[model samples]
Target: MAYKKLSEQVQELSNPQRSDLFVKQFREAVREGKFDATFLTERFTMPKTFSRRGAEGTYQRDTRDMLFDVTPDFEAWFEETNEALAQTRRTGNVKPTAENIAAGLVDFKALAEETRRKMQASYEKGQALGKGRSRTSSGGGASKTRSRKK
Candidate 1:
């Protein structure tokens, strides 16, 4: 309903004025809870021309020319790339050794587990305190306590 109207207004933006207006309206609308995710998506989607084009590669002859230029030295570049990889294999982030991957994974998992346990402990502590307060409040629900005087 409103999503279609807003999407149409956003898509038909012919000039800077309409574009700015749409942006402004969309922001205010979101802040005011006028539109949810569907409306926001429509408000933010690229125009049909840009949308129909599969992620913005050019349809020009320059791509063919570039491919032709790169084809001549492709083998040489491939050989050099392999040679560099071989030279730096020991210090590379992704080693081909199972032992190295296992060691790295073990260390990562240990740290993650320790952090998760700490977070769980904190969350449980908070929940316990909240429950205690709720119990105290529930005991006196809709009732008044009397004050003693000397």
Candidate 2:
């Protein structure tokens, strides 16, 4: 129905580009939502480029952080970490519960393995994002710099 109406409208329109622009404008009218023209309108967008002085600010995108929304392996590891922490008396790291130990989740071995996997995933995601090419000509060139110092 939308396509038919759009096509009809397009036939009436003089410019071909106007048809596309009209469809785009209609979609944006729905999805883009209402914005106040006053100073009250605001949005929190990530910075596109570095600072003027060429300073680099580090950001830790912990994909597996807190483990609440991660896989079952991560869930078990998180539960065990919490259990272990509960046993602590503000001293060194304490042991987890028996259930966790039996299941082999979040113990010294499990924790290390989980950490390794999360780190690997983080590295992969970082590499993909950092090495991604620009879709537009105005966008920056591909960076050949490896994140880690060789």
Candidate 3:
């Protein structure tokens, strides 16, 4: 049987959204000796690119060392990252705060409704304004009188 990498196993066990759960479970397995870290050298890649920066790279020299380190609390990390990302998506803010959301500063639903109402009103106004316009040409529904058959 072919050996599967830790990431491949994780992918099989869970999707992207639940990847953290797999990592947590893997760490717990490591902590309990259910899986030996040293044996995982061939099964897992070492020093993810983001963690490969300078001093941080020293701490994660191998998959075993990386796995042995304390597992992070992903829930808080996810929450903070999500909040930061939402703030980044908002425009024209020197610094976005919770108040910006609470104060209803960016109400997309309300803005969309207002735009729809304006568009409808404009369309109706155009229809009313166009009522006065006349069609100079008519369809070819009426044929010219045919000459009497010889």
Return the top candidate by TM-score: 3
Give the residue spans of candidate 1 off by over 4 A: 1-106, 140-150
RMSD (Å) of each candidate, 1 decimal:
20.5, 27.5, 16.7
User: Candidate 3, residues 1-67: lDDT per residue as tens digits?
Assistant: 2233455544343134444444566667667755444334454433223345455443322243232
TM match of model 3 to true structure: 0.25
Tens-digit lDDT track of model 1 for 1-150: 222344343444444223333445455544674434333222233332212345755321110000112232433533443344335423445543567656773465665688899999999999999999999988857748777897
Between 1 and 2, whose TM-score is larger? 1
How far in Å is the alpha carbon of 6 misplaced in model 3? 0.9
Best by lDDT: 3
Please give the range of 10 consecutive residues that has the lowest summed lDDT in model 1: 60-69
In model 3, how large is the Cα lDDT of residue 93?
44
Estimate candidate 2's RMSD in Å: 27.5
